[model samples]
Every structure is written in structure tokens, then in C-alpha cells.
Target chain A: MTAVQIIDDLVARPGEGKALLDAYMADYAPGARARGMVLDRVLVSPPLWMDDQPNTLTIVWNVEGAAGWWGMRLAAGADPSATAFWETAGARLVSRARRFAAAPEDVETLCNG
Target chain B: MAKFTALITLQPGADRDAFARNIGDATLAQPTLPGVFDGGDLILHRQVANEAVPSDAAIAHIDSAVYEPIGGGAHEPGLRNGVYRCLLLAVKPGTPEATVRQFESETLAMPHYIGTIRNWRLSRVTKASGARVWTHVWEQEYADIGGLLGPYMTNPYHWARVDRWFDPECPEWIVDTRLCHSFCAFERSVLNP
Candidate 1:
């Protein structure tokens, strides 16, 4: 099965979400090109019914491998400017990056049928 | 055969119109991608807001390239050959950090929200003008439409429990209504074979 990583967050601002997303896209652009990880789709939407939290932004990227993802993270953190950008933004980044060893078919099936 | 779906939420002050246009352009520009079969945006109705519900501005995109090759054979008529659903939501302000944290935890705990999902991450952004917003993404595969609503659309008791878990202040006033603007489109491959 394909290995996947999921990055989730609770955003604090509107424009800031766009800015961070742009930075993330840029950070992965080089690696995506180099690794041949196809750009599936970038879906941008607003928060609907999010508990009591106000400004919330959600972004999801579908990629092919873990190496490219780790490489991208390393690149993002290595840059002092990027680190500063995240620090000053007052944004909390919560990420869940995991790799699936088996294909979807080989793993446990919940309700696929 | 099961289909894949993605739900994306936009940050505050993001231009919905421009965002839709960009996605449209991207899909038109690249068509050979196997992950995306057919997709689009969802347009919401304003009247629902007057009903005291939290209306969402959203877009729905469908991808039909799953299972078999595009144009390979006839798919189930009226079933969108291999379409996948994508929903976009417009978030509001005044969302507390605690509330956000709670929401994340609750979503993760959902039965259908586990394993199949990939890249379920969130981030906060600050603009040059000092504005801030929070965003996250949920991608998963479903056997049917019920899978999407399985975790969210259920008994009121469950929802009440989730609300209490997320919001301590004014928990009773927290409603679950959302409005969305949606659309549908196909993915195109830029590089010709």
C-alpha cells in the first residue's frame, strides 16, 4: 500500500494561513519536482463548525513518499528565516506524519466494502 | 470499489473567488495525475445563514481516475465514472486555542477517521498585515457516502459530548451548522505522453 503523512493544525489567522501554505508549497516544490511526487491538488477552504475556535484553516497534501516529506521538513527548519516566520506568526503547527508499510489492500479494512 | 475524498478548509480573509480560479486552472493544466479523477468546488446558499445556522462557503471537486484508466471503459452511468468529493469551508474568527485543540482530538477519535486518512495536519498563518488564521486537512477513502458522515452525523448525545470536550465557555451555544460553496472539475495532465 502507499505510505501517507497527514499534517493537521488549528490556525489563528486568515491571511496568515495563506502565507504559511504558500511557504509550505514553496518548501516542497523543489523536492516534489526532484522526487517525481505528483502534485495531486491543493484544496483551500474555510472552517465550518469548529467548536469555539474562531479562525481555522485546513490544508491537505497527498504525496507519494516519506523521503521527500522529511527532506522538505528538514529544509523548512534549517532556514533561520523560515523558522522566524513560523515563530512570529503566532501559529501553532500540529502535524501527524506516518508511513504505511503495507498497501491499503494489505492492511486492515474498516468499511471499504 | 472504494473512492477517495478530501475535505479542505480555507483560512479567514482568503479570496474564495481567486482560490476557485487557481484550482480550476491547476486542474486544467494537469490532467494525467492518477490520484485525481474528477473534482470541483461547492457553492452555498445564503438563506441558510438566516436560519441561525453557521453557514459555510464551500466548493466540491470530484476525481474519476480511480480503479481503471481514464476513458478505458464505461463506468456506472450517472455515478461519476471515478469521481471523488472535495469540500472547502470558510472559517470564522474568535476560535479559541483550547477549542481548536479539542476539535482536533475529537476528529481523530472518530471511528471512520482513523487509518485510511493521510496528511491530517494543521497550521496557523500570519500575514504581512498582522492577520492570523488556522488551517488543517483531512484525506481518506470511503466505500460510500455514509463513511463521510459516519463520524459527524450521528446522535445529538455524541455531538453534545464532543462540544463539551472542546468548548468549556458557552458550550451550549455552539452549533454544528455549516455553509459551503462547491464546484466540480476534472484533472488534466500538462505533460503530453
Candidate 2:
């Protein structure tokens, strides 16, 4: 199976970064796991918290392949809990986005398969 | 079906009906307009089965289109006085064909997640005459203004997922930000019209 990576890049509102991260952990992460994604990593850019400026939370997740990706989407779409988390996330976030990507070695298999 | 849609900004004190006649039997709407909609005064929709939709000559700032439904033009004849909304957008020039298809698929997926859309149509613009050459028209009906502006807008499937294509901040964005988001109250199903 080809492995796929999904990234959620979120920039929190000034002074609210840590709280946003806490919310994602409490509110979003469990639902994400239920949707067939495996939490891969959570990275904080600049590796420090500051009250005056925004902090970026980069969340990475993994699923098997296209099927796994679509499965996650279908499940997430049907889940109101997932919707609620994102709706509330806006208040804490300055900007956010989710991107799909693959590793260099898996690119060919992903494209062909 | 052949369809024609127009987003018209009326000249000061222009009579709505007289100006609407230029577009030919359109279901005209004047719902609460939004900022992105560029202060449009009317949302005009007209459709005919297997016939050419005529042109318009309204002396107002208008963004109009002749299109054929590409997806989801289900009929709901009994629905009345519902809010009808239309979004006219162009995929940026030079976006990959595959990405454009993905955008279309994601857009069509909205009905699956949001139940508030009572009737909907996604169309490909065959002839565009407007402030910009719009590529697609997405039309929908909601039971009330609350459904159009509330759950429809607040739903995660809308803001988090499908919106990625429209949000400039997202790398997945392909559609230009200058979109035509106009809606108005309708007496009957415009999709049926």
C-alpha cells in the first residue's frame, strides 16, 4: 500500500497558539484517528511560545493510500463532531490549511497506482 | 436544459421589473446581498428545456452567463419563497486540468455533507458576458435565509474542505478570489425553471 501524508498547517491568533494546540488535541485529534488517519507528528515552528506574535502548528498525519484518504474524507464529512471542532477553531486561528503530499520514494507508486 | 443567469447592480432608482424584462422571464431575486457580491441588486435565473436562452440588454453593471448544468440540477417544484444562491467563479488560468476536475468534484460534494441545500445545480458556462469571463456557475436553493447564511456557511465541509479551493491562503486554491456570490428570495424552484 502506498503511504500518503496529510498536513494541517495552522497559524494561531496572537497569544492563542498554545490554546489552539490544546483544542486540536482535545477536540480534533480523536476524530481524525477515528477517520482512519494516523497521527504522525506535531511540530511548532521556532520551537517556542510567544504572547505577542503568531505561532504555527504543523500537524502531519498518515493514511495508507487513495482509498484510505477518501475513507477519511467520507467519514469526516459525515461526522458532526469534526465539523464542530473546525467551526470553533476559527476563533482561535489566524489562518489554516490542509494539504496532501507523499514522500519522494512513494511518489511514483502513488501516481501510477 | 439551457440556462441564463445574471448578477445585476441596478442604476440608481431603476425599476426592478422593467430592468428584469430585458433578460426574458427570469426568476428575479433581491435577497440580502453580501460584500463579495459587489452590491448586486438582483439575482436573475432563467432556464428552458432544449432551447436557447435569449440575451439581455439591461443598462446596468451585469455579470451574466449562458450555461448547461454539469451536475446536480434536481427538481423540487413544491419549494417556494426559498433563498436562491449562485456562485460564479473562474479557475485561475494555467491550473492543471486534473486539479480543476478535483475542484469540481469537491464542489459537487457539498450537497452530500450539507443538507440545507434544497435544490442545487453546478453548471459549465457556455457563453459568458460579464465583468469577467466566469467559468462555472454553482446554484442552490435554501429553505430560508438562516439556512443560506447559517449552517450552510458554518458547516465544516464548507469552510474547511470545499473552501480550500476558493481561499487564496490555501495552496490547494485554484479558483480566483473575485467570485460572484449572489442570492435572492425565489417563489418557486429555479432549478426546475
Candidate 3:
């Protein structure tokens, strides 16, 4: 049971930061939930945070662990809703920079219902 | 007004019954965001489904969306009664952005029940998952179904411009419409009015 933190730092069209969240909530979130991934939190950097980009939305998803994350991705391959989620998310993301890190032992579980 | 939309899905190694309980607690505990329809929350497999939506997917995710009345649309000080007509689009692959944009703009401008409320939510499919095909969703609510069947449906602007775009050759896009009766439960007015 490998626990890894999946963070996606995404950039969307100007003022389309909301679209990124909407796509996740409406399209991506459920699909990930199906595979045991909770896109539980979000952080948006100030427009001036980046020199070139204006709108950057950072979405955080805590999988049960690395095994769980990979398992979900595998399950999503044949799932129609999962497929649709990617299609929907792809159009909204201008760029997505992702990283995986180890989670702190003293983390809180907000929602994994 | 009772207006909440749910999407349900099933997945591997997921508990159907226990997950329900988690969603119940999660939904109750989830904080409300600052928005028009922010009272409702989501129920995920074992937690709150992200920060929004109470629906169930055919695959593994269940979420929801609760619509609130617009300015003065609330019959009283709170929510109101209205007929909800929601359209979830399943667009064909490679549909031109211009075509989609045009369709959205045209449909949005169509005639509708005056004083009635409408939410033309237009979006694109950007991610992949168990439940696919749904690209965008458009919401409309009126005092009666006639609003959709009458002006919204019959308006020449809708038929001539918007309808034409939903061509028979490319019919997979926006293939279904769900009509629900809004009501009130647990003290909050909902969408299907």
C-alpha cells in the first residue's frame, strides 16, 4: 500500500479557472471517485503568481496510496464515465503540470466517503 | 422547491452500502461555499465527492447539483417552484469548436418564458473516466413545462439556428433531456419546482 500525493497544477484560459473546477466536479471527480480517488481540495495562485500565465489552478487528489491510484487509472481505461471525464478535462486545461510526493503522516482526511 | 440532480456509478472494489453512509456523513459535514445554490453537498464513496455535487454515476461516482432561483425568481424570500429541464450533451468526436460555440450562443439567445429562469451551462468534455460522452450541460427552469415546449422549443431562433446544429448526422451530441418536478424537503427549496 504505497501512499503518494498526486498534485496537478493546471493552467486554463484567462478567467476559465472556474471551468477547471467545474470540469472536475461535473466530469472528473466522480470518475476518480469510482476508482477510489478523492480530488478533495484545490488551491488557486494569484494571477501575478506566474510571470507569463495569469490563471493557475492547483487541484489536489489524495489516493488511498500509490497502489490505489494506479488501480484507479487501470479501472478507468475501460470505463465510459472515466473516458468522458478526460475528454471534458482536456478541453479545459491549457497546460497541466503534475507531480507525486509522499504524504505527511499527520495529514487530515476531510472527505473520502 | 425540491431541485437536486444526482449522478450514480459503480466501480470495482467499492462498497455500495457503506459508501452511502460515508456520503451521508460527508454530505452533512461538508462546508457550504459562497454561491447561489450552495446549501447542497456531495456524497462520495467514502467521503465528500470533492467539494461539490451530489450525484451517482453509472460507473463509480455519485454526485449532485442543486439549483436556486435567480434574482426575484424566488417566489418568497427563499427558493421557489419551477420546472427543471436539464440537457446533458454527448458530443460527437471532432465537433468543431466554432460549431459548438455557435450552437451555445444561438441556443442561449432563443426565446423563453419571460420572467421564468434559465441556466444555459455550456461546457466541454475535458477528462476521461467511467462515465463518458457527457460534454456539456444546459439547465432551464420555468413555472410550467410549457416554457420548454412553447417559447423555448418553438421559438424560431431556437429551431432555425440551434436546432439545425444538432444535425441528424451528428446526433450523439446532447441526446437526452431530463425533466423533473422541483420541490422542498428538509427546509430548502430545490430546482424541480
Candidate 4:
């Protein structure tokens, strides 16, 4: 499936960072997969970022379409497991900024430009 | 599964390496700790890499997250995965060292807490840039939040026995705490635990 979105939850501490990733994987991944979202990779710092000020993480995800993204959010709200997971996971963060990111084609366009 | 974790910073000039080593070895002890929900510990340096060779000064902080990972996240012993309720602790200034040790021993005793609290841990931070707002940490995990806080915080033993050393009103409360939540990503898990 062609990818539709990417998310990044920038965090400070490793333990908390790890928790963020696991909640996505455990509570959300199964439901998300049924609707076409896959957890692509979990990236940590060093080669993962500059200067190690952010050694925590940057999670990348791929969804089949915008519909799938919305589907996941709605499903999370209705699912007690997902809701509970986020409750604990969300509090661990120092800061979180998630935004739609460039797909491979978008990246290609930028590279060509 | 849910988890709650907390931290505490080691004093300067402390034998930090020994302190870290002691906790590591404690988890590996012959008989498992009671009410730990069959979980173990993972030691981290500044929240990045596992300092297999723990340093006396390390990277200014150390975290001992207790978990029981799913998907075979490791069973025999070591950090496990679950829902965690982590807490940050601030020590009040001038509370004699002996009293602090007394409180530490009291908290660790199993009778004071409930069984659903699968895992509990502590971290000692250094004077590094990674230092947190609080110097110490502690946590316990539960299946769900439900009413864990009300009961745990109000346990007669905790308030009557342990509260003497704590003061939320003090400018520098001898023991100040905040609740947080987290799960084990186990990003560094070699076997995917």
C-alpha cells in the first residue's frame, strides 16, 4: 500500500521514550494494522540525531491512506485498552510533536527540486 | 499491565558504581522479590545506552525500570513490559541521612503496598545535563488505574508510619512526589523483549 502519514513523538528520557513506542505498538498497532497502518521503524539517537541532546526517539509509521489514520484515532477512542494505554504513555513525555511527513514520492520530489 | 516508576539521585562523591551494581545484583538474587509481578530490572545511562560497564560517575543519571515484557520480552529475570505509573521524588534539605535510609527500608518492605503493584524501582542521578527536576524516582504497576492512588496514598501504615518523614507543605518537603505514567518500549531489547 502507498504510505499516507508519518508521526514523530520527540521525547527526553529513554525509559519514558520507550514507553511511548510500546504503547503505540501494543495498544494501537494491532487495531491500526486491521485498518492499514504499520509501525515501520523505531529510531533512537547517535546516528539517529545530532549532538545527542535528543537520544530518546523518533517513531516512523506508514498508513494506507488518510481514512486509515482517522480510523485509528476513532478506534482508539472507543477501545478501552488503547485509551488506557495512552493515559499512562502520554504522561511520560517531556514534549511531543507529531506531524504529517513526506512520503517517498514527496521526498523524491524534494530531492529532484 | 500498568507500571509506576520513581527515581532518586545519589549524592555527589557517592560510590555510584557500587550503588548501580548493587541494584543490578539485587534483581538477580536467588529468591525473587515478593509482589514484583514476576518482573526484573533494566539499568540505563542518561536514558540512552545500557552501561554494561557501569561507571562510578556514569552519564549523570541511572534508571531502573521494572517491567514484564509481552511477546517473550524475557521471562526468567530482567526488565519486563507493562503499563507503568512512574513518579518523581524530591528530597527535602537537611533531613539527616539516617532518616532517609529508614524511609527507604520502610518503602521497600512488601507489607506496606498492595500486590497488584507488580514492580517498583529507584534511580540515582548524577550532576549531568540530563539531570531531572527531582533527584530520585519510584514507581509501581497495576492492571488499571481504577482507584490505586486513593488507597495506596491513604494506607494507614504509609501515613501514620511513614508520613512523619514527609511534608508536602514544607518549602523543601522532606519528601515530595509527583505521579507519572509510562510503558516499556524496550527499544534496546536485544531479543525483542
Return the top candidate by DockQ.
Answer: 2
What TM-score does chain B get in every candidate?
0.34, 0.85, 0.47, 0.44
Report the C-alpha lDDT of model 1 over A51-89, residue by residue, as the tens digit: 333444443444433444334433543445543544444
The C-alpha stretches of model 4 lying farther than 4 A from their native spots are A1-113, B1-82, B110-112, B127-133, B168-173, B176-193
Tell how far residue B127 is off in model 4, in angstroms. 4.6
| Alpha carbon RMSD to native, model 4 | 21.3
Better of 2 and 3 by TM-score: 2
lDDT of 1 at B24: 35
Per-model chain A TM: 0.43, 0.96, 0.71, 0.62
lDDT of 4 by residue, B1-193 (tens): 3222323244455553455455552212111122222122222223332324334443334334333222111121233443344444456657787766666666655233444444455443332122234544454444334323434443434432444344231112366433222222221221212
TM-score of 3: 0.34
- Alpha-carbon runs more than 4 Å astray in model 1: A1-113, B1-92, B111-140, B149-152, B155-160, B163-178, B181-193
* TM-scores for every candidate against the unseen true structure: 0.26, 0.61, 0.34, 0.31
Candidates ranked, most accurate by TM-score first = 2, 3, 4, 1
lDDT of candidate 2 over A21-88, digit per residue (tens) = 99999988999899999999999975888788999999999998766876776686577787678778
- DockQ of each model against the real complex? 0.02, 0.07, 0.01, 0.01
lDDT of 3 by residue, B1-193 (tens): 2123444434655554554444553312221122212112222211112334334452344334433322122332333343444444455568787766666665555423223344333333333222334555455455555554445543334432354344331122333222111211112223222
Which model scores highest in lDDT? 2
* Candidate 4 - chain A - TM: 0.62
DockQ of 2: 0.07
